[model samples]
Target chain A: GESVGLHLPTLSVQEGDNSIINCAYSNSASDYFIWYKQESGKGPQFIIDIRSNMDKRQGQRVTVLLNKTVKHLSLQIAATQPGDSAVYFCAENKATDKLIFGTGTRLQVFP
Target chain B: SQTIHQWPATLVQPVGSPLSLECTVEGTSNPNLYWYRQAAGRGLQLLFYSIGIDQISSEVPQNLSASRPQDRQFILSSKKLLLSDSGFYLCAWSPILWGLRINTEAFFGHGTRLTVV
Candidate 1:
């Protein structure tokens, strides 16, 4: 079965440092990718999204990069903060309108 | 300005018990509704979606089913629940972006935590 996976189960970063989370997906037909932030015992929150037509998308303080050739997706946070600490998940939306999610990487920002 | 609501924030039910989780979307019309599940320390799994009223699509074959009785009301139900069905259920709605396909972002509710013993 086609699915998505993250490179790390957990990532620790300094409060003032930048953070990058990596994700790999096996579904080549996927055209849309999204990054979500989930806090403790809460539903996932939308962070940013990128389409196949473009390789990069930027939001307020977050950026999403897509490498179609490698089927890789990444989310970058500038000056990571304590509030940025959460479980990050990369989701791929196939042509069928179904989203398959990656395991997730827990981002821990040290104060 | 859209909001998604999922109710019975937490539940404790025994195996083989019937289950029903409600999700309602407000401030949006004809939005795409979705149901997702997340196990302990796992990722969000897509369970069902509805593009319109009375339209439902199931992604996995399981003891669960979905219904869209109204335009923005989606329901997840199970005739008999299993122990493995215990998890967090989330409902989301993707607003119409430019009146095109599903190219917009999704708004998620707080979520329903189910514990099936």
Candidate 2:
């Protein structure tokens, strides 16, 4: 079965530092990938996205790098803040426009 | 300018009770709407999706059903709620723009926290 998963289940970083989260996907046909942030009690918020044709994309303090060769994806956050603590999800959209999301990585930033 | 609205923000219903959660989009017409369920300690599972009015496609078979009555309104309903239905339900939509492309961006509304007691 085609699936997307994270390399770490949880990640902790100190405020003002940097955070890196990794994901690996199995579907080669999945042309679109997105990273979302979900706070404790809200829906997932769109962070950044990358198309299969592109290897990298950046937004604000975050950067998304796609390694199609290894089927790997990563999200890097600079100057991590307390507000950055949340569950992060990586989703892959297949040709049908259906998104398959990873289990999620819980990012805990300490002040 | 597109906004997705899903409510009630939270719900507590007993098992066997009927369920209805509504999601309406303002600023986008005939968008592709989707319903997803996030169970405790689990990932987001796609339940149903609709591309247009009265059109629906179910990916998972459960006690849930979805409907698109208008171009911008999508609804998820069930004859009876189950304990397994207690989870986070999110409504999302993609712009009804060009042809099918995996790179299309989708946005979500404040999810509905469902708790079946």
TM-score (chain A only) of candidate 1: 0.98
Compute each candidate's TM-score over C-alphas: 0.94, 0.95
* Model 1 lDDT tens row, B85-108: 999999988876677666656778
Residues B26-79 of candidate 2 have per-residue lDDT tens digits of 996778899999987667888998888998999978999999989999999999
Question: Global lDDT of each model?
Answer: 0.91, 0.90
Expressed as tens digits, the lDDT of each residue in A1-111 for candidate 1 is: 899999999999999999999999998888989899999999888898998999999998899999999999999999999999999999887756566789999999998
Candidate 1 total steric clashes: 0
**Measured against the native two-chain assembly using Cα atoms, what DockQ does each of the candidate structures obtain, in the order listed?**
0.67, 0.68
Give the lowest summed-lDDT range of ten residues in model 2 chain A: A92-101
Return the TM-scores of chain A for each candidate in numbered order.
0.98, 0.98
Supply the TM-score for candidate 2: 0.95
